[model samples]
Target chain A: MRRLPLYLMLSIAALMVLFPLLVMLSTSLKPLDEINHGSLFALPQDPTLAAWTKAWGGACISGTCRGLSVWFANSFAIVLPALFCSLALGALTGYALSLRTARWVDMLFAALLIGLFIPPQVTLYPMIVLVREMGLFGTLGGLVFAHTVWGLAFVTLLFRNFFLSVPRDLLKAARIDGAGFLATFWHVMLPLSLPVCAVALVLQFTYIWNDFILGLTFAGPGQQPVTVALNVLAGSQFGQQEYNVNMAATMIAALPTILVYLLSGRLFVRGIAAGAVKG
Target chain B: MQRVHLQGIAKSFGATKVLEQIDLTIEPGEFLVLLGPSGCGKSTLLNIVAGLEQPTGGRIHFGDRDVTDLEPDQRDIAMVFQSYALYPTMSVRRNMGFALKMQGLSTAEIAAKVADVAKLLQIEHLLDRKPAQLSGGQQQRVAIGRALVREPQVFLLDEPLSNLDAKLRADMRVELKRLHERGRRTTLYVTHDQVEAMTFASRIVVMDKGRVQQCDRPEVVYAKPANRFVAGFVGAPTMNFLEGELALLSDGPALRLKENLLPLPGLWASRGLQVGQKVVLGLRPEHIGLAAADDVGTCPGHVVMTEPTGPDLYVRIRLAGQEVTSRMSPGQAPSPGQKVALELDGKAASLFDVADGQRLN
Candidate 1:
C-alpha cells in the first residue's frame, strides 16, 4: 500500500516515454485511408505488409520509384570508412597525448576539446568551399571525410579519458622492455583498450550512419546516404504521400543504428562505467 | 657485472627543482639503497639512473658507456615498480618473457630463461595464471621474475614491497635480500622505509629535500649520522633530541637541560665549546635505561606512558617539561605515572649545533 503510488507513477512515466515510438509503429502498419484520417491512436482498419515492402523496395523520390537498398549501401560505404578512420586516428592521438607530456600536445588537446562545442552549421559554408577546393564535393569520400572530422572530438575525448585510466606503471614497464611508441601502443596499450574501442566503434557507427546534415550536403545524388534518401521519399513533392512506404523507409534508415545499440549495449555500458569511475 | 656512476645530476620541472647536483657511484654487485622520506626525490633519482627520466643536467655511465640520453630500454636495466606493474592481460610465463621476446630472442631461449626465473622465485606453478588470479605476494614474485629473466646490467626497484601487508613486506624483504645475494647484481633500490634500508642495503644514501644528507654503510649511518636530519630520519621511534646549553664542568663539558644536567664524554668535550653555546643532544631510545632513584648517574622523571611489545617495553618519561622515550627490557617495564630515574649512555650520545643542526664532531 505504501509503494502503490510510486509504482503507479513509474508505470505512467514508462508509458509516457514509450508513447511516441508506439504511435510511430502503429501508424506505420495502418492503411493509407486510416492514416489519411490522422487519428494516430486508431489501429489499422486492415493490416497489410504492402507498406513495408513498398518502403523497402519501391519508394518514390523526385518522380523515380526505387527501393532504399541503394541508399543503404551508400550509408554503409560512407559510415564504415568514416568510423574506422576517425576511431583509429582518435586512439592514436589519445595514446600519444596521454603518454607523452609536452606543452604543444596539451595545447593541441585543448584545441580539440574546444572544437567539440563549435556549431556544425558555422563550418558549413567554409567546409563546402574547402571540399570543393580538394575536388571532393558531392562524392562519397567527401562525406566520409566530413563525418570523420565531425566525429573525431567525441571519439578522441572518450579514448583519451579511457587511456588515462590505465596505470602509468604498465606504460613504464613496456618502455623499459625496449618498446618504442608504436610497439607499446600496438602490443600493450591497444590490447588493454578493447572495451573503450568497442565503445568508440558503437558511438561513431550510430552517429555517422544516421547523420542527415553532412550526408545531405556533401553526398551527391549518386552517393546520398540512406537518411537523405528517406527524407526525399517522405517529403516527395508531387505525389500522394505513400504513408506505409514513408514509415517503412524511416524504419529502414533507423534499423542499423538500432541494431548496433541492441547488440553492443552491454559493452557500451561497461565501457562508460569503467571510463567514468577513473575520471 | 656493471658499475653505475651518476655525476652532477640535477633535475627540475619548470622552476621547481626536484633533484640537485646529485652525485653517487654504485659499484659492481653492490646493493645500494636510496632511502628518504616521500617527495625527497629518491625515486626520481632512481628513475634518472634507469633512463626512465632524463636529468636536466648530468652525465650517467654504466661501465664506461655514457647513457644519460638513452631510453630506458636501451640502457640494459630492469625495474620493479612499487605497484608491481605486472601485465594484467598476459599469463605469468608471458609476462616474464615479454622483454626477451621484444628483443627478438628465440622462443626456446625465452622459455628456458622464464622457466629458470620462475623456478627460482617459486612461482613455476603460477605460469599459466594471469596477474589478477594470483595473490599479492605471488604477483610481486612474478614482477621480480620478469626483471630477472632480462638479466640486465642493473636492476632498479622503487619501493617494490610498499604495497604488501606488514607480514608480507617483512617476508619479502628477506626474500629480496636472498635474491640479491644469489644474483649479485648491481642493484639500486629506492625506499622510504628505514628498516628496509638498514637491513638490505650494502650502502645507504639518506636523502632529504632533493639533496643527499649522508651516504655510508648502514651501521655507520645508524651509529654516527652526518647531521641531525640523518640522525632523526634513520631510526625507528626516532632518536630523542633535547635542546640545551653546553657548560664546562670541573672535569669536562656537559649538556644542561632545565632541571637536569647530562655529562658529555671526554672525546666530545675535547672539541672546543663555549659555556653558553646552544646545542642539541641526541640519544637513541634503546641507549637510555631505567635506574634506581638514587643512582649516581641518573636524573629523575615521571612515567608518562608504557607500551610493551612482548619482548621489550617502550617507556615514555616526562622530564623538564619534555617527553623522552626509553626502550627497556620487558622485565623492567614501568607503570604510567610512576617516578623513575633516567640514565644516559654518555659515550653513545651525539651533540649538534642548535642553529644549523650540524653535528659537533
Candidate 2:
C-alpha cells in the first residue's frame, strides 16, 4: 500500500524529465495539419514518414532543400578532429603532470587548473581575431581548434585525477627496468588508463558534437555543424512553419551524443567513480 | 658482482632535513639490510640507491661509474616495493618480462630467461594470472620474479615482506634467503622487522633519525650495539635499561640502582670507572634468569606477571621499583604475585653513558 504513492511519484518525475524528448518524437511523426491543431501530449492522428524524409533530405531553408544531412557530415568532420586532438593532448599532459615531480611542472598544472574557471565569453573576441589572423577563421579547422581548447581543461583534469590513482611504484619499477618516459607511458601507463580515456572520449565527443556557439561563430556556411543548421531550419522566416520537419531535424542533431551515452553509460559511470574516489 | 657506494648523500624537503650526510658501501654479492623503524629514512636511502630519488647533495657510484645523475633504468637496479607494485592489467608472466622487453631483448631470449626465473621461484604455473587474481604470497613471488628477470646490478627491496600474513612472511623469509643464496646478486634490503634483518643480512645497517646508528655483522650488532638506540632496536623484547651510578663496592665497581647494588663484572670495572658517574646498565631478557634464593648472584623480587609460550616463559619481576623480564624454561615457571630471585648474566651486560647514550667500552 505504501509503494503506490512512491511508484506514482517516481513515474510522474520520470515523465516530467522525458516530456520534451517525447514531445519532439511525437510531433516529428505527426502530419503537418494534426501537429498544427492538437496538443503536444496527443498521439499523432496521421503518423507518416514524410517529416523524417523531409528532415533527412528535403527540408527547405532560404530556397535550399538540402536537409540536415550536409550539416551532420560537417559536424562529424569538426567533432572527430577536435575530440581526437583534445583527448590525445589531454592524456599526454595529464601523464606528465601526474608522474613528473618537478617544481615548474607543478606550477604549470596549478595554472591550468585555474584555467577551468575562466569564462569562455571573456576571450571570444580575442580568439576570433587570433583565428582570423591565422587564416583559419570561417573554416571547420578554426571551429575544431576552438572546441579542442575549450574541451582540454575538463579532459586534462579527468585524466590527471585518474593517473594519480595509479600506484607510483609500478612506474618506478618500470623506470628501474630501463624504460624511458615514453616507453613507460606507452607500455605501462596508457594500458592502465582505458577507463579514463573512455570517459574523456565520451565527454569531448558529446561537447564538440553538440556545440553551437563556437560552430556558429567560426564555421563557414559550408562547414556549419548540425546544431547551427537545425537552428537555421527551425527559426527561418521564409517558409510556412514545418513543425514536424523541424522536430525531426532537432532529433537527428541530438542522436549521436544520445547513442554514445546509451552504449557506454555503464563505463561512463564506472570511470567517473574510479577517477573520483581517493585511494 | 656490483658494488654500490653512496657518498655525502643528503635529502631535505623544504626546510626539514630527512636524510643527512649518509654514506655507506654495499659490497658486491652481499645481502645488506637497512633496518629502522618507520620515518627513519631507510626506504629513502634505498630509493637513493635505486636512482628513484635524487639526493640534494651527493654522488652514487656503481663500481666505477658515477650514477648520481642517471635515470633509474640507466642505473641498472630493481626494487620490490612494500606494496608489491605489480602491474594490475598484465599477467604475471608479462609483468616479469616487461622490463626485458623494454630493454629491446629478443622475444626468444626474454621468454627463456623468464622461464628459468619462474621455475626457480616456483611460479611457472601462475604466469597466466593477473596480480589481483593471485593470493598475497603469489603476488609477492611475481614481484620478486619481475625483479629477478631483470638481472640488474643491484636489487633494492623496501620492506617487501611487510604486507604478507605472519606465517607467509616467515615462509617468504626463508624463500628470499634461498633466492639470494642461489643468485648472490648485490642486494640492499630495507625493513623494520629486526628478525628479517638478523636472519637474512650478511651485514645489518641499523638506522635511527636518518643516521646510521651501527653497521656491522648481525651477531656483532646484537651482542655489542654501538649505542642505546642500536641496543634497544636490534633485539626482540629489547634490552632492559636501569638508571644507576657507578660506585666502588668491596669487590670492585658496582652499579647502584634505587634499592639494589648490582656488582659489575670485574673485567668491565678494570677498564675505567669514575666514582658517582651516571650510567645505564643494559641486559637482554634472555640473559636474566630465575634462580633459587640461596644461589650466588641472586637478587630477590616479587613476580609481576608471567607470559607462557609453550617451551619457554617470560617472567616479569619488580626489583627496586623497576620491572625486568627473565626468560626461563617452562618447567621452572614462576607464577604471578610470587616471590622470586633474579640472576644477572654479567658477561652479557653492557654499560652506557647516561648523557650521550654511547656504549662504554
Candidate 3:
C-alpha cells in the first residue's frame, strides 16, 4: 500500500516517454479522413496498411512519385561505410590513447573534444569547401566522410574511456607474449571490448541514419537519405501535407534506430554500467 | 637456461629516482628473490630485469648477449603478474599456446608443448575453461603454465602470490619451488613476504627505500643482516633493539645500558670499539630467555604480555624502561606482570652503530 504512489509516478513517467511514439503509431495506422475526424487519443477506427505501403513505395516527393525506399537504400550506403570507418578509427584511436604511451595523444584528444561542442553548422562551410576541393562535394563519399568526422570524437571518447579501465597488466602480458602494437589491440583489447562495441554501433548507427542536415547538405538530389527524402515528401512544395502518409514515413524512418536499440539494448545497459563506474 | 647479469641499473621517474646503482647477477637455474616492503623498488627492479621497464642507466646481459635495449619478447622472458593477468577472453589452451603461436610454431608442436605443461601443472582438466571460470589457484597454475609453454630464458614473477589468500599462497609457494626444480629455469621473483623469500630464494636481495641493503642467502640475511633496516625487515616478531653505549668492561668490551652492562661477542675486537661510543644493542628474540634466579649476566624484567601460536610463546618483558620480546617455548610461558631475569646470548648478539645503523663487528 505504501508503494502505490511510487509505482504510480513511475508508470506516469513511462507513459510520458511513450506518448509521442504512441501518437505516431496510431496516426500511421489510421487513414487521413479518419485521422481528421477522430481525436488524437482515440484508437484508429478503420486501420489499414495502405498508408504504410504508399509511404514505402508510392508517395510523391517534390515532383517525383518514388517513395522512401530509394532513400532508405541510400541511408544504408552512407551509414554503413561511415559507421565502419568511424567505429574502426574510433576504437583504434581510443586504444592508442588509453593503452599506448604516445605523449601527444592526450593533447590530440583534448583538441578533438572541442569539435563535439561546436555546432555542425559552425563548420559546415569549411567542410563543404574541403569536400569540394576533393571533388566529392555532393557525393555519397562526401556524406560518409562528413559523418565519419562528425562521429569520430564521440565514439573515440567512448572507446578511449572504456579501454582506459581495462587492466594494464593484460597489455603488458600481451607484449611479453610477443604480440606487438596492432596484434595486442586485436587479440587482447578488441576481443574484450564487445560490450563497448555494441554501444558504439548503436550510437553511430542512430546518429548517421537519422541525420538530416548533413544529408541535405551533401547527399545531392537522388543520393539523399530517408530523412531528407521524408522532408521532401512531406514539405510545403508537395501541395497538401498528407498527414497519414507523413506519419507513416516518419515511422518507417525511425524503425531502424528502434530495431538497433532493441537488439543491443541489453548490451547498451551493461556497457553503460561497466563503463560508468570505471570513469 | 641463461645466466642474467645487471650492471649499475638505475631508474628515475622524471626527477624522482626509484632505483639506483643496482648490480646483481642470477646464475642459470638460480631462484633469486627480491624481498622488500611496498614502495621499496623491488618490483621496479624486477621489471627492469624483465625488459618491461628501461633503466635510466644500466646494461643487462642474458648469457653473453646485451638485452638492455631489447623488448620483452625479444629478450625471451616470461612474467607472472600479481593479478595472474591471464588473457580473459581466451581459454586455458589458447592462453598457454599464445606465446608459442606468436613464435609461429606449428599447431602440432604447440599442442604437444601445451599438453606437456598441462600435465606437469595438473591442469589438464581446466584446458577448456576460461580464466574467470577457474578458482584462484587454478588460474595461477594456468598462469605458470603459460610461462612454461614459452620456455623463455628467464621467469620473472612480480608479487604473483600477493593477491592470494594465506593458505593458497603457501600451497603455490611449494608448487613454484617444485616447478623450478623440475624445469630448472632461472627465475627472479619479487615479494614482500619474508617466508616466501626465505623458503624459495636461492639468494635473497633485501631492499629498502630504493637501495639494496643486502643480497645473500636467506640464513645469512636472517643471521647477519647488513644494516638496521634489513635486520628489522627480514624477521617475524622483529629483532629487539636497546639503545646503549660501547664501553670497555673489566672483563672485555661491553654495551653499557642505563643500569646494566651487556657483554659483547667474545671474539669481538676492540679495534672499532671505543669508550662511551653511542651504539644500539641488537638481540634476536630467540636468543633471549628466562634466566634462573642468581644467574650472572642476567637482567631482571617484568612480563607485560604473552602471545601463543601453538608451537611457541612470545613474551613481552619491560626492561630498562623499554619493552622487549622474547620467544619462549610453551613450557616456559610466564604470566603477565611476573618478574623474571632474562639472559642475553652474548656470543650471537649483534651491535649496531647508533649514528649509521650499520652492524659493528
Maximum-DockQ candidate: 3
Query: In lDDT terms, which candidate is top?
Result: 3
Candidate 2 overall lDDT versus native: 0.86
Candidate 3: misplaced stretches above 4 Å? A100-103, A276-279, B248-253, B263-271, B292-295
TM-score of each: 0.93, 0.96, 0.97
Worst 10 residues of 3 chain A by lDDT: A270-279
- Winning model by TM-score: 3
Query: How well docked is model 3, in DockQ terms?
Result: 0.85
RMSD of 1: 2.5
- Model 2 clash pairs? none
Every model's DockQ: 0.71, 0.77, 0.85
Model 1: per-residue Cα lDDT over B1-361, one tens digit each: 7999999999999999999999999999999999999999999999899888889998999999999988998889999999999988889998999999899999999999999998898998999999999999999999999999999899999999999999999999999999999889999999999999988999999999999999999999998888999999998788999899887666556778875676554436437767878888888998788765655656678999988887878889887678988999988888998987777776788878888888886
- Ranking of predictions according to DockQ: 3, 2, 1
lDDT digits (tens) for residues A156-271 of candidate 2: 88878788888888888878878787987788888888878778888789888988889889998788888988888898877588999989989988999999887888878888
Candidate no. 1 TM-score: 0.93
lDDT for A84 in candidate 2 is 90
Clashing pairs in 3: none
